[model samples]
Target: MTCKEAQNLVMDYINRNLGEKKLESFLKHIRECKECYEELEIYYMIHFAIQRLDSDEHASYDIKHMLEEDLKEAEKSIRRWKIRRSYRYGMIVIAEALLCLIILTQIQGLNAGSMEETSFYRLFFQEETDR
Candidate 1:
């Protein structure tokens, strides 16, 4: 992602509104681009600060740690999503293969039935057929 694109997605990233694929890309860009990472960090600090102001709680909050945790959680979420998607894809493939095998079995049964009816061996005795 370009700096411009990453900059545009800063709020979405902070809000956790990005989809898994989009988030993955954004995270990759943020980790690699120093300027963009700093920009995101600045935005996160401001956003968190505003939230803290509105809340009645007086506990001290670690903004930097919170940001790091957010990033790590996002990564973990993306990995879990990827694993689920892969399993789903694998199941679909297996289902398709089973359906194909069933169809082939049905076709073979029909062909066998037709062959038995039309073949000349049926007209003869079992002993002659063996000869």
Candidate 2:
């Protein structure tokens, strides 16, 4: 087999999943090519490292620990921002309500003062016309 073909079949050979003819071809290539042999060794080392972790009950813990920490920090920051935004909106609402109330009060006071002035002018003109 060519080096490329053998390299492709190396994983299947290591897992004992290759057919008899394919296995023989892959093994022949391994025997002839030092580079392919070393490549296979490195592949086996990585495979074994993963396999060793496979049996550990806490494998998920190690895998997700950093990600979970980051997620929690992100959630906290989002919540803090949301709370700050809500307080800002609340303060704006309150300020707008107070401004509306002040305007309404001032308008009512001006209307009452104008009515009193108009009544005083009507009374004074009626008395002068009678005289």
Candidate 3:
């Protein structure tokens, strides 16, 4: 196998994924060519590093932790909004109730003050005096 052929097959050889016939040819080339052996070592190291970074346990744990933190923040935001909404609704109800009380009191006051001379007591006293 030439250096170029061995270089092309380096990745498959490192992964042990080459066919038996190609594996044998690739190994023979590496044994005879110091340059091809070094190239294989370089490619193998790079592939291993990539695989380590892609490990399911480490990568998934980090991602899961971040998602959990985000969920917690979202829950906190929802709780804060609920509290504010409740306070706002409570304030609006109180304001409306106070407005109703004020209006009722004003109407009662108008009826009481407007009945001075035309009131029932004044008319009844005047009729008795005339009789």
Candidate 4:
């Protein structure tokens, strides 16, 4: 496998999610590519650091509450984004309907003008024919 492919699979390899054959290929590429090897090492270090935090037995009640609050804020932000998107789509539909109405009205006005012109010409010709 190419170094790029191996790098892309590094997360799966670290998580033990890759099949045996693919894992072996990824390991082989990492062994041959110093850049990928270093990148994997850095990722492993970061994973280790986070794991260490998980193992910490001392947690304050305030920290737990703070984490919950942060999660609530994230949920609120997502909800706001969804609402904004819905409003934007609603506005677009309203605008399109208004535009269609305006266009139809213009077309109706043009047809009316054409009909009146045709009627005027017919009346004028009838007078000439009568004379």
Best by lDDT: 1
lDDT of 4 at 125: 57
Candidate 2 versus the native: TM-score?
A: 0.41
Which regions of candidate 2 are displaced past 4 Å? Answer: 57-131
Residue range 32-117, candidate 1, lDDT tens digits: 99999899989999997888889966888788788889899998999999999999999999999979866765676577875343
lDDT of 4 by residue, 39-85 (tens): 87766667655766899845433443443454355445556766898
- Candidate 1 stretches with Cα past 4 Å from truth are 114-131
Rank list by TM-score: 1, 4, 2, 3
TM-score of each: 0.82, 0.41, 0.40, 0.42
Model 3 over residues 38-110: C-alpha lDDT tens digits?
A: 7866665576557768774353234334433543554455567668989999999999997986676566657
Q: Alpha carbon lDDT of residue 129, candidate 2?
A: 67
Q: Against the unseen true structure, what C-alpha lDDT does each candidate score? A: 0.83, 0.65, 0.65, 0.66
Candidate numbers, best lDDT first, in rank order: 1, 4, 3, 2
Alpha-carbon deviation at 113 in model 3, angstroms: 99
- How many residue pairs collide in each prediction? 0, 0, 0, 0
Location of the lowest summed lDDT over 10 successive residues in candidate 2: 59-68
Q: Pick the candidate with the highest TM-score.
A: 1
| Model 4 local distance difference test score | 0.66
Residue 39 accuracy (lDDT) in model 1? 96
Total clashes, candidate 1? 0
